[model samples]
Target: MKMNMFGLFNKKKSDTVSLPYTTDIHSHIIPGIDDGSPDVEHSVALVKQMQEWGVKRIITTPHVTEETFENTPETITAAYNLLKEALGEDAPEIIFSAEYRMDENFLKHVKNDILIPLPGNHILIENSFLQPFWDLKGLIYQLQLKGFNPILAHPERYAYYYDEKEIYTDIYNSGCMFQLNWLSLAGYYGKETRNIAYWLIEKGYVDFLGTDLHNRRHARAITEFLQTKEYRKLVEKLNLKNDTLK
Candidate 1:
């Protein structure tokens, strides 16, 4: 597949260009695996775009819900292989993991081999959009007991926690890392999530930044984000965007 530059490989970005935080351990870029890239061509394109943004490695995380994605290790591996075949040897290092939803049956997945672990012992977790789990703390503790460090993806967007400012700190203190969606900082999830992303970053609570690149829509938000001076400056100033892999 031929690569087109959507400012992906263009490194002559302004001093305002914020580098990526780290390898995106959460994304739906795997074709048909989740709601991300539609097929092989689109997946390859997304990968090229990530490369242009200076992402050295990308762990494509397709969703694995008991009812929805249901992406087992075998299914995800097949998607990885297909993506590689499309990109050829020149493709970036593409790894496979999953974004697992924390549900009533989540504990069973933790016990079974159905769930995939994020790189470096991290487990990407998502909760409901309406309300947080009643046993949220216990669930996280269960994940910890299983020897996996759970990462709460897009913590700011959860509606229930918007009023409770300390929810972020409380969860983080419970041994979970926070992954902020790049679009949230750019107001993609609306003004509330955007403000929360900034708030968390300011408070030194956001450990990682994720593109959460679901599709072309998300791609557009990231493009806009890169053009901003603060976005570029924060990554370098705090050393949060580009230095975590070391």
Candidate 2:
């Protein structure tokens, strides 16, 4: 397996490695709901490829942004059902969830008690790419107050927080868990994100590692990344909670 400058992989299907854990907590596999898989065929293909890489269970998280995705429970479940019907019994166990952007829609869902959580009542939340949300600490408090365990999604991708590394510690200290995008360590997002990922690992702040699998391009990068010496070294020292999801 080989990786290119664009972070895509050139490899055969046989060039695979077992994932560190079976359950992928962050992925966008629900068909047509977001920017992940465009249709059921694509969703099936991604899942099959993931199974080949030894992911036995997947908690597929589609985007739930206000203006962009606007994924309600009804829409998400509909897409999930369609994908499951297409896959039949020849795939990994898949659970439907949402990677919620901390926006008004999310707050509304929280108030209405309409959010879908992971197996352990864990909710994956994302911040805006351009800036951290104005009241992230308040939002985390609200989620916790409502009995939801919040897991911040892909902190390394937030460029605004890069210079203020102490804020990462503050969020973790606020009782919110952190989930690092595994591909970030593979330089899939770029050198800066990869550096932040390693920094989070060194800080003992990353509680989970997720694929955040969007499409085939991401899958290829991750598959090739899993076979690298860097991946082996990183996993050896870090204590990840991915397997505990089941």
Candidate 3:
């Protein structure tokens, strides 16, 4: 995909990769390979959008599920190369990670050395947003055993877990880190999700923040959110310790 799709701006070196949104660790902007930024051009648009928002480092994570999109390292490698070509070396640092679907198949993959580990042994993980995991406790136990910390993506969007507050505490105590999506805070995922996002922030339950930018619609939402007092409060309150981010 060409960077022309979203039209990269002609900015100075210092302006190009400034840290307005220092670390965006979760995104589906890896192009047409998953249920995300469509094609290479679309993915470029997503990254460029993030770059404009002051995101210096982007860890683009596509979905890896058992029923669908059964992504492996080989599959991610090819896409990563293509994405690298699209972004060029001068672009902001782009890393590869996967938002793993914590399903029955996940256990097997984790055991068989098929799962991709996030930098520093951090693994981005997601459960069904519609339903709570049937055996969530056991799954969390397995993740701990694998020596990887599971970072749950968009916990606010999970309908079932929002009602059961204990599930959040359980997951937190289970040693799973939580990430909140930018759009969720902007009410793009609906009011319920917005409430949950704020609740996590207010209660100090969130560990990290992400763009989760898949397309222009999400891009616009995040752009607007970054300007809000609420977004400022969330980040300033957290003072997240993502040292590798520039």
- Best TM-score among the predictions, by candidate number: 2
lDDT of 3 by residue, 1-246 (tens): 424665443333343323235778888888777888777877776777777777778877888887788888888888888878988876888888888887877777887988777787888888886676787778777777878777888888888876688878888887888888878889997898999988888888887888777777777666666666776666666745454433
lDDT, candidates in the order shown: 0.75, 0.88, 0.76
Question: What lDDT tens digits, residue by residue, belong to model 2 across residues 26-113?
Answer: 9998889899988887788888877877888999899999899999989998999999999998867898888999988888999999
- The alpha-carbon deviation from the true structure for residue 220 of candidate 1, after best TM-score superposition, in angstroms, is 1.8
For all candidates, what are the clash counts? 5, 0, 3
Displacement of the residue 73 alpha carbon in candidate 2, Å: 0.8
* Top-scoring candidate (lDDT): 2
10 residues in a row with least lDDT, candidate 1: 237-246
**In model 3, which range of ten residues has the least summed lDDT?**
10-19
Score residue 148 of candidate 1 by CA lDDT. 79
Query: lDDT score, residue 75, model 3?
Result: 87
Question: Candidate 1: what lDDT?
Answer: 0.75
